[model samples]
Target: MSQRSFRRSIAIWLAALFAAYLALAYFAAPEFWTFRDRGFRTQHFEMVTHTPQGIPGDPINVGLVGTQKEVVHAFAVAGWDTADAVTLKTAIEIGESVLFDHPYPDAPVSRLLFDGRAQDLAFEKPVGAPAPRRDDGRVWETPCGGGGGRPRWGGSASFDRGVGLSHDTGAVTHHIGPDIDAERDFLMRDLATAGVLISTGDISGVGATSTGRNGGGDPYFTDGEAIVGILKQ
Candidate 1:
């Protein structure tokens, strides 16, 4: 074959191969994975939590496949303190801590509801001043069971950026940062680093949202994926 003709044929073959690769990588593979994951998606319970007044709170962005004791131990190993329930004395302590720039490592967090009940467990990791920044996760015992019939704990992980007034009710509250997915990943990373996580996988949540507002009217965004960790047994 002529040199020019041979070169042209080779160029055409390379272009076709690249196009096929793109099709599989961007389209076919995603579709296949989605189909495979549909069964797992249906196992999730409530996608978001609600406030005392029934307003939608934060979206569930993390989960744990374990018993209550295992769940608590995992967070503890990850350097998170189980939050104290909001009460008169604890409330006053958090208020004082915030006002005086003190570190109340296990401060009380406002209650958020899932399945018409207050969170089964809540954990917090204070950052710098407890009032200005903190990592929080509110967990609920989900009806769905994981492998080996272990109870699943669905949770909403969020970062409290600062204390402020609630935009909806004018009540005092903590405003969360918008990128909740970052908080979710951060929590998972902490657990993994602490060797408390056996394995991690993603499930569907409130779907991808760029303009979601929680009960406090604080704006937030997420990739709509919840990471579920199987804690070390």
Candidate 2:
């Protein structure tokens, strides 16, 4: 073959190889990693919490790494009030707060079960007038431990949009806003601002969905990523 023709052929081969590399690096490799990571998350994380009746409750979108005391202190530093347990006195107080538009900084939140047990801790922050609208989260100490043997707490953070009846049981409840991802970020920001977070990263949750329904049958959406924060010791 002529030298010029051989050079042209070599150039063509190299160009084709470069195109294949680009496809693998930009498209195929990323897709493979995504699938693999999703499977890993599914196997490792409890993606959602459940209602007492075994109905699926909120998707867990937050996590923390610390001891029980450290977790509580982090939230306290963030100005979040520890939620009162549901009791006769607290229930009556919430009822009056809803009816009379009174400010109950620490209010009782509905119970949600994770790993077949109720949350270990709950916290809330009043949004404004109209006592029902608030930011609340429930944390459960998972069996998993984080770096340095610290316990990991799985959490579901959501914004209560308004008071309403449960679509499943027709009982009174608070409807949550649809954008749960925003609520997750909101909580993370609060913790970071409180100077309690040492570092933050993400883990997989329920997976991205535009049409997710909680136990209350309220429509919600999320990016399906849970933010995991390592709290200061």
Query: 1-233, model 2: which lDDT tens digit per residue?
Result: 99999999999999999788667644665454455433332334468876655556899999999999999999999999999878999988888988999889888898887766789999999998656999998999999999799999999999998898777655568999999999999999999999999999998889998999997889999999999999999
Cα lDDT of model 1 by residue, 99-160, tens digit? 89989988888888777678999999999975558999999997889878999988999999
lDDT of each: 0.85, 0.86
**Candidate 1 deviant stretches above 4 angstroms:** 1-44
Instruction: State in Å the error of residue 11, model 2.
Output: 93
Give the lDDT of residue 155 in candidate 2: 96
Worst lDDT window (10 residues) for model 2? 36-45
Stretches > 4 Å off in candidate 2: 1-45
TM-score of 2: 0.80
| Residue 227 lDDT, candidate 2, scale 0-100 | 99
